[model samples]
Target: MNQTTNTVHQDVEYWLKNIVVGLGLCPFASLPLKENTIRITAFLGTDTEELLGFLEQELTTIEKSDTSQIETTLVAVPNCLHDFYEYNLYFDSIDRLIKINQWEGVFQVASFHPDYQFSGTEPSDRENLTNRSPYPMFHLLREDSLEAALKHFPNPEDIPERNIQCMEKLPEKQVNELFYYLFNKR
Candidate 1:
């Protein structure tokens, strides 16, 4: 792989390990990650159509691959969807694509962006960091695995609240330092 690809993958993995799992933002993530079942693919494209095509290919790959080998997939789009608003707007088309492809229940998409912010929250709110990643990414999770994880997890409804609380307690300096690379362009 090229240097850019290596750097992207490393950044994504670091976020997954440090912020996501390390902070217990997603309690279910650690297991799959430890087992090496999470697939992180980088698509270096700024065009929306090309990114969507890559998303389609990754979805198909997940659908055909063995569940035991690949529990989830993260399509890291470092070039496109840098703007959170544009990234949010693209979800409708993403959902449509899922439904059109008859992957409604079989697969689900979760979004993470560098500037992700919850509705009604200010741009600088610390809670927004919960959904922020090293880059814009479309996280594809298998419904069955998610269901299984949820079944074992107690009070799954409290996850977002808990994550928000955790993020809120973090010092702004630490948060900014950890994610500085995300906001700064190469």
Candidate 2:
């Protein structure tokens, strides 16, 4: 293979390995489907071009995203304002941008997490959710598959404190499954 091909291969593999090892889950794990399938879409976002630039640069290292293997898509947004994306077009634009960069991932962008412009909601409470001013929630999978291990892995607290609060409600085996799903195959 040529130097360019090797570089792209290494880049894509780097993404896969980081997601699998660093996050304790394969990047592919985020793409789980119902009934032991992979979700095509996963969520990720950043507050500034700094973070987005990092992800984009890393992803660009890959030759292609290979979305054809996925049943759905993996949507990543930059500048996650108001805890989510505001317009479908904006997110869709993100998806397009990913494809344009030569990554072979698949995903459809949605407009959830509205402006959070409601009345009567506590300022502190709302602020808690939006403390960072902008948040990014990943919505992976074509249908609904919360059963997947890629439950709630946002950009923060990923350092593995070993006391994940959500682990309580779930069973031991289920938690293991999640860990394996997210942690294995790095």
Which candidate gets the maximum lDDT versus the true structure? 1
User: What's model 2's lDDT at 2?
Assistant: 20
- TM-score of model number 2: 0.26
lDDT score for candidate 2 against the true structure = 0.35
Off by over 4 Å in 2: 1-32, 39-45, 50-70, 73-80, 83-99, 102-107, 114-186
RMSD (Cα, Å) of model 1: 2.1
Give per-residue CA lDDT, model 2, range 1-186, as digits (tens).
Answer: 122333333433333334233344333343432232322222233344443454454343222333334343333232344332254334554565567765434322323232322334443332222111111323333322222324554543452233223333446575444334223422
lDDT of 2 at 116: 29
Of candidate 2, the 10-residue stretch with the lowest lDDT total is 126-135
